[model samples]
Target: MARQLDLVDFIVGLPMPVAASPQANPLDLLPRRPKAWERMVAHVPAEDVRISISTTWTRVVVEQLREDGCGDQLRANGSIVSHDVPPGLIWPEPCRLILMTATSAARIHKRWCLEEAPGTGLTNTFRFARQQHADRAAVSQQLRLLGEGQS
Candidate 1:
């Protein structure tokens, strides 16, 4: 039997799929940069250190489970769904809905310039940070070596 969806089952204004059909390339879902991207990049230093962290969105189900004697208590559970996870699987709860979204990879990448591991990549920000932490002398040595077109 089909279960009737309640008000709590709805996630208001959830985004529509990027394409008309499931067979469409998933990359179509990737967020696009704004027209001001270059101007925005100009403000961010090229030498700035960048990192990627928890960048997945999730949804949860919360229910008010009433015990025999105790007052109503909420039991909550959730699953991350922003990745390439297959959808339409049965959630244990009837009214599973997205309560909040976590940081997304597109948002993170838009905010920070992600590059390959520092020294080998186009930027040496991490190497600079490491050297700075090690000693001022180490930084000077690195700068001198780089000045000589070595490192």
Candidate 2:
């Protein structure tokens, strides 16, 4: 006993908010960017070298690099991550890349990155991956496809 429709709205009527994980002590979106930068240095070990960075959007690069990261110690203490790569792992480069994206290039420039720390050697794989509304676009596309299929 259900009615069927032939069209769907890609936009959800009520959108959920994009909030920081409270378990990680959620922060305002803007502040989270800088915090991510510091954590990138700490969480990723020195032995792991950079293979390729998607784009030059510094903050997004930093944010994605924190994929392997946990918690927000960096934000609270203002320190970079300091983890050690295991002995056997060959520092997964080439395959390991960070994808950073934002609405505009100009916005990405404001994240206030600490630049390349002089002593940290340029070998470290810390870079950005840019996307054009990739996340939202992907979700919308998926929803649309689902709707079309249902019809």
What TM-scores do the predictions have? 0.19, 0.21
Q: How accurate is candidate 1 locally (lDDT)?
A: 0.28
lDDT of 2 by residue, 1-151 (tens): 8965544543454577998643211111122345356444444542231222223433422322323333222323344444444433433331122322322212322332111222322322222223222233333343344334433
Clashing pairs in 2: 42-80, 42-81, 42-82, 43-81, 50-125, 61-128, 100-129
Candidate 2 TM-score versus the reference: 0.21
Off by over 4 Å in 1: 1-38, 42-134
Q: Tell how far residue 4 is off in model 2, in angstroms.
A: 62
| lDDT tens readout by residue for model 1, 90-134 | 222112121111233223223332233333222322211222123
| The 10-residue segment with the lowest total lDDT in model 1 | 93-102
Please report the candidate that would top TM-score against the real structure.
Answer: 2
